[model samples]
Target: MPKDYSLLSELADIFKGKAVPAKAEPGEVAIINLVDMTPLGIAYEALRTFAADTKTLSPYLLEAGDVLVASKGTQHKVAVFEGQEFPVVASANITVLRPKEGTNGHYLKFFLDSEEGRRQLKAADHGRAVMNINTKELSSIKIPNIQPVKQSYMAQRYVQGLADYKRKLARANQEWEKIQADIERQLFL
Candidate 1:
């Protein structure tokens, strides 16, 4: 199948994350720091929270369908923010990608996490003590121009597949444990 490529800038609003230095005591807002990024997704429960004044954070506050990409790291993990109970914002070491209406944020994340997508993003890597991806490079990166509906469908399947895989892996582990227990019992007998 022929693939169409579109610049990321054409599909999303690319911008850097906020640089709030200190977190207020008894934090009121959650920050998606680079440390919170994982291979699967952002660790919402483990995010650093700060008692930020909402008014000042309004611009940087993440929307429900916004996508996040770790900017300063060897692996630029990507995730779609599904919104949180408390207001959430991206940290300095992260980049916030607000998808245009034509693009699906989940699909964008799925593509960015794909092997080909990672290769494209690696072009932005400037070798140094710590690797970094600038907004300009990210904006210029080309993305597969799949229609929004198709992207949505693909994203759903990708998410469902991950869930199914995790469930099966856990069940396999349980089965293995049971077999191991029986083997130990037989050996003792």
Candidate 2:
């Protein structure tokens, strides 16, 4: 039998409030937007803007473990911030959900991306043509009940995979640079 999951509202008491107001400007930190978000997760390569002073932007500053869901545009793109780096900012189209203490952010993120979670998002979706999720509807969505340990394990695996891919790309670039250097030397010699 599957474990029972509860409506996100049940966990509302966990989150203190919505995102904080920005006290700085853009470029102060990495900014996440709907364009930057992809089904696979945050598309780091797609990220185009940064907040110079995150303090100036309201609801843009992000902390570790914050789940960013696209509030506007096409539904289904969601991303989670694991806090690997600091000074990250979220876009207005992205609503940030901070799980209550004790709950695993990775767990919540996975649950949100699951089939059931997507169904709820589709159901709560409003607007006739555009389709969007208001904060109230987003907060009321349901999340699956999974063991925190399992959540951590899965999250770690995903993180490691991404890291490995990044490292491989870096090595490939270095090899290409060497090839280019050799060609340049031969051409001049």
Candidate 3:
């Protein structure tokens, strides 16, 4: 099928994350440091809470649908910020991409996770020790200008498929363990 495309900047607001250095306190908002980010999503287990007041970090605070992309290290690494009980924000080295009305956050993430998307992003990487992607370059990246209904359909299936795969994998592991146990019992007998 023929596909339409547009510059990412046209469909979303792309900006760098905050640089607050304070560690999160017990009950404050969680801070999504570069260390907390993963290839496909944010590592909630690795997130550190911010110690400062939420007001001080208001602008950097993330909403549930925001997409966070790495500006340093692995350039195309991205994560979706699914809001939790506590609030969250991205670190300075990451970029927060908030989709506008025309764009879908999940679809954007899926595209960025694709091989073509990674290739384009990596091709734009620059710097010595640590590679980086600036907002200018990141914004210029092309994305599919798909219809909202279509985008939503694809995104939902992609998410559901992942959940189904994980469920099947867990069931398979349980079956394997049962087989192993049965074999051991038979051998002992």
Number of the predicted model whose TM-score against the real structure is largest: 1
lDDT of 1 by residue, 112-175 (tens): 8888778877888775877688688889988878877898898789779878887998999999
- Candidate 1, which segments miss by more than 4 Å at Cα? 22-24, 169-189
Model 3: CA > 4 A from native: 1-3, 22-27, 170-189
Clashes of 3: 4
If ranked by lDDT, best first, what sequence of candidates would result? 1, 3, 2
Q: Residue-wise lDDT of candidate 3 within 1-189, one digit each (tens)? A: 438788989888887888776643556777788778765467887777657778977788888778888888744477778878887878888889998996778888888888878877776677667878767888899987788899889878977887788799899999999999999999989
Cα deviation in Å at residue 24, candidate 3?
5.7
What local lDDT does model 2 show for residue 4?
84
Cα deviation of 170 in candidate 1 (Å)?
Answer: 4.8
Off by over 4 Å in 2: 10-29, 44-60, 84-86, 164-189
lDDT of each: 0.84, 0.67, 0.80
Q: Considering TM-score, which of the candidate structures 2 and 3 is the better prediction for this target?
A: 3
What's each prediction's clash count?
A: 0, 16, 4
